[model samples]
Every structure is written in C-alpha cells, then in structure tokens.
Target: MAFKLPVHCPSCETMLSVSQLSCPECSTVVSGNYDLPLFLQLTRDEQDFIMQFILNSGSLKEMAAQMGNSYPTVRNKLDDIIGKINQLKNKNGKDDD
Candidate 1:
C-alpha cells in the first residue's frame, strides 16, 4: 500500500483530504489535485538515502561506501529523486498560473 499523509482543518477540526486547500475559515472548498510536501512525499528508502547523502556532505562515493552500493546506483537514485522534486515543483507552479 502506498503511504499517505493526514491533513486536518484548523477551523472545524475536521480531517481533510490530501487535495484540500482551504479551511472552514474561508467557507470555500478549494479544488484540484494537491501534492504532499517534497520531503514528506519521498519513500522511506529515498529518505534514508538522502539522509546518508547529506551526512556524507554530498559525496556520492562516500554514500555508496556507506550504503554498500555502487556509485552508479547511488547517483541514479539521487537523480531520480531530484527529477521527481523538480517535476513536482514545475507542476505546482503551473497549477498556480
């Protein structure tokens, strides 16, 4: 099963859907798809990889050594995650237009 984050309304104490954008304060139901924050959206494995990468000071070689993975594997995972983040950012920007 895919993981999902819980959202809540600040005004009515109601559980909100991930697509929600407005609270009862505005008396409006915001429309369209909503995405989770980038850090939260990442899978556990990706998050772990990122944490290790950061601890290694952006050194892919060190990350590979620490994770017992090849340099290419680490690089590919980083690239994939970065691409996802960029895509999400672009999508959000387009939505705002």
Candidate 2:
C-alpha cells in the first residue's frame, strides 16, 4: 500500500521539515532540517488532483472528462494550482535571498 507523508503537525497545523530519512534495506540514514519539496508542500487533495492531471497528459479537457467535471471547472482547478505553485516559488525565492 502506498502511504502519504505528513507535511504538517496534526494538532497545530504547522508545516513540518524532515529531520531524518533511513533506508530500509541498507539501514543507511541521513539527518537534517530539510525543507519539503514544492509539490510535497501541497495538501493531499491537491497532490491527488495534480497526479490525475498529469496522468491525463496535462490535457484539461481529458481531465474534465475523467473527473466528470466541466471543462471550465478543470481549468479553474489548474489555475488555482498554478497560483499556489507560484506562491511557493516566490516564498522560496525570498527565503533564499
């Protein structure tokens, strides 16, 4: 079964950073205050939507058909995701400066 990674604290809803990662086979480990990737920073539902959109080959019309939503609805969803991605990029850019 596929598992979803936690991106925030359940109690306080604060964003989380990775402190450690380990390999199950070799037992190798790495530790640090790692920032989450841009995609992983989105909510689970958003991630799922993105996956579906990708699987549909980035065609909004195809995604609308698969999702049983209207074309405009799918377009709006894409626009929303794009906005959030831009916001994340801008935030990271500011942090890097």
Candidate 3:
C-alpha cells in the first residue's frame, strides 16, 4: 500500500519540514529538521503525472493517450512541473537530487 506524505501544515500555508524518521523493523527512530525534496514538495497530482510519464517511457504523447489529454496539455503540465522544480532548487540554493 502507498501512503501519502503530508508536505504542508493544514492550518497554515507555510512549507513543512521533516523532523523524524523511524525504522519499522528495529524500532529505531532518528530525528532532525529536514526540508522536503523538490519532488515531494510538488502537489500529489503532479507526482502522479510524473510517475505516469516515467511509466510511459518519457513520452508525452503516450502519457496524453493514457491520461486522455491532448499532447500539448500534457507537455504543458510537464513544463509547469519543471518550472516549479527550478524554483524549488533556486529557493534551496541546492539541487534536491
């Protein structure tokens, strides 16, 4: 099963940071303030689009067909995601990768 990661606080629009991580097997926990990756900071829908894009062999035309959208629309969506990622990288002053 897939769990969605919450990237923002519900009450405020401010960006959120990860403060802890746990190991399910060893029952060990690690904690610290960490920013979400540029990709994870994107909206869920955008993440899904990226997954679909990869599954389609990086073909926007294939993604459009699978998503029932026009090729241009799919390309535009990808372009928008790229812009957001660039902005995030600039804001962080580092590459999320």
The candidate scoring highest on TM-score is 3
Question: lDDT tens digits, residues 2-89, model 1?
Answer: 7555444579855344666677786888777655565655567777878888889999999888779999998999999988767756
Error of 1 at 20 (Å): 11
lDDT of each: 0.73, 0.87, 0.90
Question: Which wins on TM-score, candidate 1 or candidate 2?
Answer: 2
TM-score of predicted model 3? 0.90
Give the clashing pairs for model 1. Answer: none
Per-residue accuracy of model 2 over 28-66 as CA lDDT, tens digit each: 999999878888998788899999988888898998888
Q: Rate residue 13 of model 2 by lDDT.
A: 91
Clashes of each: 0, 0, 0
Query: Which residue ranges in model 1 land beyond 4 Å of their true spot?
Result: 1-35, 94-97
List the candidate 3 regions with Cα displacement exceeding 4 Å: 1-3
Query: In model 2, which regions exceed 4 Å deviation?
Result: 1-3, 94-97
Model 1's alpha-carbon lDDT is 0.73
Ranking by lDDT: 3, 2, 1
RMSD, one per candidate, in order: 8.8, 2.7, 1.6
